[model samples]
Target: MGRKNISDQRRGEIIISFYEVSRSLGLENASIAKLAQHMGISKGLVLHYFKNREELLLGLNEYILEQHLRVMVSEDIGKMDCKEHVIHFIENLFTRAWNTYFDDGVFYSCYALVYRVPEFKESFKAYLIQLHEVLYKKLEEAVAFDVIVATDLKELTEVIFALIDGAYYYLGMYNEHDLAYKQQIAIYVKYSLRLLDFRS
Candidate 1:
């Protein structure tokens, strides 16, 4: 690999190790030393990639953003049409599938730092905007394809995201298999589709 690719790969490795350790141990207790120990690497090597805890936290936010963005585009979206894109999004939005991406505990932990860290706040803001754009673009395509009619695509996107954000935060507090959890997800999905006037 090239020098830059190797550097990027090394950063990724260190960040993933950081994430794993943070999940196993709370983010407050997830230190550079613990991450190095978990990865069986030297503390110096970890510092070589991230100079300090703040820098490491910034990198972790980048990693978190990458994983969260993956939820916007399914592997099958390329094969599906515009309408399928919208359906695929709605179907996956309220699911516990995000667990496969990143642990909610670790995610919220990083989020807490946003109040104190400017870089973390910017990175998080980017995540939110990117997420909105991804779905907004898809909804625009659906409108062009004559799949769904909407008066305001932007408003629709925000409304849907509001439901998702609210439902996600509420649902995270309960067991995924709980009846209230499942029922609330169903109710949100139903209303979200209804807002889009989506018959499917």
Candidate 2:
């Protein structure tokens, strides 16, 4: 690869390391020196890429949001009828993606921090709004196709996302092994469908 490409790749690696370290250890405890040591690189190299801790953290937050959106939009949830789409959506959010992306507990930690840290709150809210829009569109298409019963698509989408987030937060807090998480999520999915009066 070109030098620029190599440098970019290294920077990406450093950012990821920073995120992981910060997630495991609180932001206050995760320092540049520790991150560099964890990555087996010098602190100067980390600074060479990020300039400072704030810049590195900003990049990490942006990277996490982008990764989350990528996962949310990856599947063709709009292709299925409303019921099928809802089922698939729940499966993706509560089963597959949740198990993969959030199993480490870092995402929830960052989410909690966003509430306290003024720096991350705006960006986090923006990401949430974008995700809500995508989900609302999918639900609207489902309602139009008669896959689900008539309901407010935007409201329902927000409720579903909130429920998913709540479930994941609890799972991360109490059930890290994910043993009973699937069953709990299934219950919530069924309850949500009933609220929408979905026949299927």
Candidate 3:
């Protein structure tokens, strides 16, 4: 049991190093040998954990999902009530907070793999579905607490994520300081609040 735990920890460490390297270098350039050097370990050791770049990317997809959860949802949202939670949730999704956790280039590179490999496609879908599930739960809570109206929670969750996906992809082209970036956030938030029937 102890050995299994250690193995999982080691595998997670290697995946994190892979994410960092992929951020600096392109994902295609982030090879296993490169990850080994980045960790100051050996290629053979890295291989022991990840058989190849394909498997390592599968691990990276999991890492991206974990980071997205941190950005999109929260446990108690740092003691915030449901209303504060809704606003923070919306603002965080549109802001640069994700930059602190994962790189856009590294993330999208992994996303592109969804088109190439079946297993990779499933992992990527898991990433999206995981986010959707958590957000749906949060929306349910907001309705329970009267923070939002009791509409079709599932449908509203889907619409919100669709808006979020579109906002991020388009806003990625603009600098965070650009007026266009701020405007997009405002525009999306306004409609999202309307959907939730948010008064504040």
Candidate 4:
């Protein structure tokens, strides 16, 4: 949104409205008018703060990343042993992504828009880089503590992340029960453990 000195509460409300509207109606169909309608406010109000749909989307994307980071940072991972940290990381990755349709839907929607909207590519890439950094650091810590043997930390992080991403996509596509979706997570976790030379 605009760099105007808006109240944090108000800005948060606007970001959530954008998220809800985009989730309900695909991002392609979400407009300032639609968001205003969803928020029970006037479009002029939204425009006054955001200036444009792109700005609103950018703000919402940042909000999404902030929310994810809060969840990750809130974890007491530092207190856990290397092996427990690895398990928690894997479990948190899958569970967090599967929590809601809006979360993943808006996520991939922003991802899709990155190709056509050049302005968004950097933000999306930065988000991915942050996630990669988190995973890479965790893997390095695991290797340092001899919890796992990974000759190439970067490559191992990519492999583990790719498996989770693939499983997350597949689970989102089906209407199966959450238990079934979690079974998919278990499978990915099993494969990741074996690949990382760690036994669960």
List, residue by residue over 1-200, the lDDT tens digit for candidate 2.
69999998988888889887877777667899999988998999899998898677677777777777766766665464646666776566665464445324556556676767787787778878988887777667667777777677777887888887777666655563575766787787787666565656
Q: What is the C-alpha lDDT of each candidate?
A: 0.85, 0.73, 0.85, 0.76
Prediction-by-prediction clash tally: 0, 0, 0, 0
Between candidates 2 and 3, the one scoring higher on lDDT is 3
List pairs with backbone clashes in candidate 2: none
Clashes of 4: 0
Question: Residue-wise lDDT of candidate 4 within 1-200, one digit each (tens)?
Answer: 45444556677899898898888888788999989999899999888778899988888878777776655554555632467777777766666544543477788888898888887888877887787787788777777777877578899889888887787788777555677776877787777877776633
TM-score of each: 0.92, 0.77, 0.93, 0.80
Model 1: worst 10 consecutive residues (lDDT sum) = 76-85
Question: What RMSD, rounded to one decimal, does every model reach?
Answer: 2.0, 3.4, 1.8, 3.4
lDDT of 1 by residue, 70-187 (tens): 8777775552245666666787988988888999999999989889989889988888888899888878777766678856989988999999989999998889889988899889
Comparing candidate 1 with candidate 4, which one achieves the higher TM-score? 1
Q: Model 4 off-target regions past 4 Å? A: 1-9, 74-80, 96-102, 144-146, 176-182, 198-200
Of 2 and 4, which scores higher on lDDT? 4
- Model 1: CA > 4 A from native: 77-85
lDDT of 3 by residue, 1-200 (tens): 99999999999999999999999899999988889899999999999998888999999999988998987765536422468778877777777888888899998898888889999999888789989998888777777777777788899989999998988888899899988889988998888777886534
Ranking by TM-score: 3, 1, 4, 2
